[model samples]
Target: MSLWGKTDSFTYIMNQTKNLGLAVNVISDYDRTNANEYIKRKNVLVIIPSLVENSPYTVYECLINNVNFLASNVGGIPELIPQEHHAEVLFIPTPVDLYGKIHYRLKNININQGLLNHKTILKKLGLSQLNEKTTGAFKKIDEANSPLVSVCITHFERHHLLQQALASIKSQTYQNIEVILVDDGSTTEDSHRYLNLIENDFNSRGWKIVRSSNNYLGAARNLAARHASGEYLMFMDDDNVAKPFEVETFVTAALNSGADVLTTPSDLIFGEEFPSPFRKMTHCWLPLGPDLNIASFSNCFGDANALIRKEVFEKVGGFTEDYGLGHEDWEFFAKISLQGYKLQIVPEPLFWYRVANSGMLLSGNKSKNNYRSFRPFMDENVKYNYAMGLIPSYLEKIQELESEVKSLAEHQWWSFCQ
Candidate 1:
């Protein structure tokens, strides 16, 4: 109705095609069932003008739906104009105001929801991005607590799985939490059905559904982060189940340790098989190590059960967007560890990270490729993991070779080939 800003911004929001974040993009979508060709684009920014607040879809797109960034001229918009970590809160007076939807507000210029001309920026401090796929596991929080907590679940093509994950949160002991579902480019009929379920069934529980760009997990999480209001934030996956006390435990731990990040082991179980050996490790938090060698620690990298203080997440600039599909958490952990943030890897198995057999090796390979791709940007984690997985095998092979050599030499004095 009120075309307050230039047409480009409105056109951008109105013409969004991908269903990547469609659930979150579509206001009140409960079933989360739909499919579309909406690609989660990057490098392009979105500016949600104050004028479109009257539009039914404005809050969904502006808040939950992922955008590189957003700039808004704030006022009385949607009753629930999605609030991220530091999207312009309470609204700004300036018409051309920028609210750094992905980042936070600075003393100088407010970052628009969309384009952030680095040159126009007085100082450019990169904000951390979040995983496109966050979880919606609910947990208890005290009423007097300083900051509220919100749990976000990001889903791509796994609508049925997403329901299981969200239901676990819905059934949590914690009632003070909210659930935000991120539809990461899953524009299918089934996905839309699930989105509708979330919006209609759980409205009283502060439930919200959103869409994210075709952008991978990092951006998806970042997109969810854009809409979260909790003083603290928690993550979960669509396919995994959460403990009744999952959120309660993490919040308690965060309160106890005063650290930015805290994690507990996720229970590893299969449909009908034994748990993988890697999932059986005994250790919890990554044993602290020097920067050069920490990447080599196999125990430190996985995200089966992990939590980070919201402040710590914002401080670390979130997950690296470059890692579209894999190794995003590894890089995130490495970066935060290097920054002297206190972390607690709780030994308790409080969550479930489903490493299903359907795509087990394939998942590992993709993660490995992402690790290799990101290895160049950071440290040589590839060599580190390779050496760890290989050196033992090489040693065993050498021992066998020595046994053969010894037996052959007994038969013939010069058995070098053996």
Candidate 2:
């Protein structure tokens, strides 16, 4: 048996397998060429004894290559396997359980049957259908008939990053787009110089730049929205680099679903790595759609970088312009949900979100007193439900406070106070 994985746990895994009297050829490093060659071998059974997993790509790879695999019945693994073959494909992740399954698969090696089942599984999951649907949608919407999307990008002295953001916009596959670059009172000489250089180019491209005096992100976005002429508005931060198909995919989804607001998944990039591949630095953030019970306390409504209908945005009164609170997106999304606006997720990572050590989010964390300022947007029922969700934590805190009070009462100074 050949073992292929990262070097971090190779030594430990080798030791454990050797102790079990299993003869294993360990290949610590993972390479596509080596993996492809290994999978092509006859009578090869891929073993995945993962204790925990979430939508492992190994299953997909095996299915696509028509290779059979025995995986642990954990997480989303079972969901990916065909129901009829679950008894043969899934194991308990224990040595004895894995050994039995391995022996069974080896004895009954039927590549033709496996290949047919794999194709059926892939089709059922809609993995094979996504590309066709996307291509069809793209062909249906031409430049003349496509709705104009006004991309509102807010900038605050990140001139160097702004260049990449603007470049991304220019490289978009969607041609019916207008750029609204809002400069929120940039004080740096470099910022002014860069803006001045791009002014003529921006004007020629029919883009507008709105200048404001340190109004923060919320106000800046709102100001841009006011100047926008498109039917749909897209919000983007100066630090974010959008994928080429970002706008196109969003527009198609909006038209198809008739959703009032749409948000896509994002891959996180640390610092100023503008255009990194998916998950090069960190995991992809798959933001969930708006749910009032969750959105009231958490920002489960995705990022501010979303495509929204202009009328819906206007109805929600735009983003809350609280100076440094840093949750205007959450508040705005929650408001939309409260008012019965249809919000949907595109289910694809179409942008790169830059994560820095210091930003509005960090500053906002320091000012927790203003965290609940968005409560005004929530109605009485929502507030009550949110409070109920906090009851467990509140009760724990109350117990601690009561213990402290009892300890103080037992002190010698307590009698003098009474």
Candidate 3:
């Protein structure tokens, strides 16, 4: 009959309640203890009208005190309530329906009978009871004993896109995360200003910022890794956004599989002309089958879409700083494979990769130097593999000539001229 909270419809509510002969209590602010006691002793039904919620903790109190509850079944509220309590909790879709439910509950007509299955409720909320004790999976995720994930991000201008990437990490379902931001010498005044503002915002949210006087992706990332103090390190790009469940999904899969490195497919953002490698090559799961060649390394898992244990990085020695155009991830992962470390594919699109219509490589940097540097990196790696006997000499011979194969072809006119 009456409404609470700050509302502009006070006049309408007061007239309606008066006409219905019901007293409407209006309290602007009150003591927390008194309110809790009042809610426990007096309130017959608690109605939460908000259609959107992150997590409704008040519902927990209501359920614990054995009070009848009603709410709009939108956003995360429905998920918080147990499936068995669907009918009893009264997820009314409209004002008329809410009134009808209230009338039924008032008459004690057993409208919500047999709807409180606590076991199923706890399970839906990712909780359980072993023996007589309740176990909370959500609680365990934030405990100090849980593995802390270090998310390493490198930035060089593009303030337009960096905010989204940072926000994605903040929104992750996994809570034990420490963000390491390495600013690779932002040259522009606007970039510096924007980055300073962003730094202030995220510093309060638990992100560490490292500064560099020069621009190098490999070096910047290595610097960030040095500052990280987590059990695992997940590399991310400034241009990409991660899904909310990305970390949780990857961490769970990694723990279960017991792999030193984990990779996931990425969803492409902003360019239909370019297709994701995962979409094109669905069978590219790791533990790369018998293909210890140069080309295999070219198409291996990407660092932006992967998670590596900290020990693996320490063993292989972070990233190679020579190639700044960014082939370090492929080379690092390849070395791990050759060294007998296990790699597992999560087989899900966990992050977004930004692609433009023209220019630039997958890393979002457009430099002619990349083509020249990447070639030697690939060739020298193959040569090393051959010298180490990891790959056969015949394969090495084939790889060496791959770049000049077109020029070395025999001409058909030579026989006619002779």
Where does candidate 1 have its weakest 10-residue lDDT segment? 31-40
- Assess the local accuracy of residue 399 in candidate 2 as a C-alpha lDDT between 0 and 100: 86
Name the weakest run of 10 consecutive residues (lDDT summed) in model 2: 365-374
Candidate 3 Cα misplacement greater than 4 A, ranges: 1-145, 271-297, 358-418
- Candidate order, TM-score descending: 2, 3, 1
Better of 1 and 2 by TM-score: 2
Score candidate 3 by lDDT. 0.67
- Per-candidate TM vs. native? 0.50, 0.62, 0.51
Error of 1 at 317 (Å): 1.4
Candidate 1 Cα deviation (angstroms), residue 372: 6.0
Question: What are the per-residue Cα lDDT tens digits for candidate 1 across 50-101?
Answer: 5434444544453444433343434444244333424454335353344333
What is the C-alpha local distance difference test score of each model?
0.57, 0.81, 0.67
Poorly placed runs, candidate 2 (over 4 Å): 1-139, 276-281, 365-377, 380-384, 388-418
What value does the lDDT take at residue 115 in candidate 1? Answer: 21
Cα lDDT tens digits for candidate 3, 205-284 = 77898878775777888898899998899998878778888888878877666789888877666732233324443332
